[model samples]
Target: KTSLVVSYTTNGYPTEYIPTAFDNFSAVVSVDGKPVRLQLCDTAGQDEFDKLRPLCYTNTDIFLLCFSVVSPSSFQNVSEKWVPEIRCHCPKAPIILVGTQSDLREDVKVLIELDKCKEKPVSEEAAKLCAEEVKAASYIECSALTQKNLKEVFDAAIVAGIQYSDTQQQPKKSKSRTPDKMKNLSKSWWKKYCCFV
Candidate 1:
C-alpha cells in the first residue's frame, strides 16, 4: 500500500521499507477537462493501528481496498479484515478493490519463496470474484514498481468518488435546478471528497 501511494505521488519507488502509521497526499488531476483535487489517505493496515485507522474513514468518499497479488495472505486479509472494517465505518462509500505488486507475481524468486510455503499469487479472476462478493465498485490490478495500470486505478477511483458524491447529494437538490446544472461542481470540492486506501 505504501509502495502504491509513494509511487503514485513521487513517481518513484522507495529505497527502503519504512513502516507508516498514516500518511496522506494531495494531487490535482484533470477529469473530463475539469480540475479535481484528490486527497489520498494511506492508512496503516497492521494489527497495531487497527484502533486508529477508522478515525480516517469518517468523511471518505471512496476507498481503494488493496492487496498484494504476490502474497496470498494479504489477499485473504482483504476479505477477512479490510472490507468489513471499511464497511462498518463508511457503509455508503464506494470501494475499488486493487491487486498490487503485479510485476512480482511472476518473479522467479518470489514464486520459489511462495512455492516453499505451498502458496501462489492471487489470480486476477479470483480478485474480480472477490470484488463482486464484496460489492466493490470495480477491480483493478496494478504494479507500483513498473507503474503498470497505476493511473487507471486512480482514474477509476476519481470517477467512482464523483459518482458517489452525486448520489449522496441528489436528494438535496432544489427542484428549480435542472440535472444539467450538476456539472457546475463547487470549486471547494477538495473539502468534501477524500479517498482512503
Candidate 2:
C-alpha cells in the first residue's frame, strides 16, 4: 500500500520501507473538468492496529481495499477480514478492490518462492470473482513499480466517490427541494473523502 501511494503521488517507488501507524496524503486532480481533492488516509493494516483502524472510517466516501497479487494469503484476507470490517462501518461507501504487485505475478524469482510453499499468485480471474462476491464497486489490477493502470484505479475511486456523495445529498422526501436542503447540500458538497485499507 505504501508503494502504491508513493508511486501514484510521486511517480516513483519508495527507496526503503518505513512502518506507519497512520498517515494521510492529498492530491488535487481534475475529474470531469472539476477539481477534486483526493484525500487519502493510509491507515495501519497490522493486526496490532486492528482495534484502532475503524476510527478512521468515519465519513469516508470511498475505500480502496487492496491486496498483493503475488500473495494468496493477502487475497484471502480481503474477503475474510477487510470487506467484513469495511461493510460493518461504512455500508454505503463504495469499494474499489485492488490487486497490487501486478509486475511481480510472473517474475521467475517470485514464482519460485511461491512454489516452494505450494502456493501461487492470485489470478486476475479469481480477484474479479472475489470482487463480485464482495459486491465491490469495481476491481483493478495495478503495479506501482511499473505504474500500470495506477491512474485508472484512482479515477474509478473518484467517480464512485462523487456518485456516492451525490446520492447521500439527495433529499429523502419526494417533494421538491426546500431551501434548508439546498443550504446543507452547498455546505457539504465540496467535502470528499476516501480511505486506503
- Residue 170's lDDT within candidate 2 is 76
Candidate 1 error regions (>4 Å): 171-185, 190-194
Q: Which lDDT values do the candidates have, in the order given?
A: 0.85, 0.91
Q: Which candidate is the best by TM-score?
A: 2
Off by over 4 Å in 2: 173-184
Number of backbone-clashing residue pairs for each candidate, in the order shown: 0, 0
Model 2 poorest 10 in a row by lDDT: 184-193
What would the TM-score be for candidate 1 when compared with the true structure? 0.90
Error of 2 at 51 (Å): 1.2
TM-score of each: 0.90, 0.93
lDDT of 2 by residue, 63-177 (tens): 9999999999999999999999999999989999999999999899999999999999999999999999999999999999899999999889889999999998777885887
**lDDT of model 1 at position 186:** 52
lDDT of 1 by residue, 39-144 (tens): 8888887899889989889768889999999989998988899899988988889999999999998899999999999999999999999999999999999998
In candidate 1, the residue pairs with backbone N, CA or C atoms under 3 Å apart (3 or more residues apart, or in different chains) clash, namely: none
lDDT of 2 at 131: 97
- After TM-score superposition, what is the CA distance of residue 196 in candidate 1 from its true location, in Å? 4.0
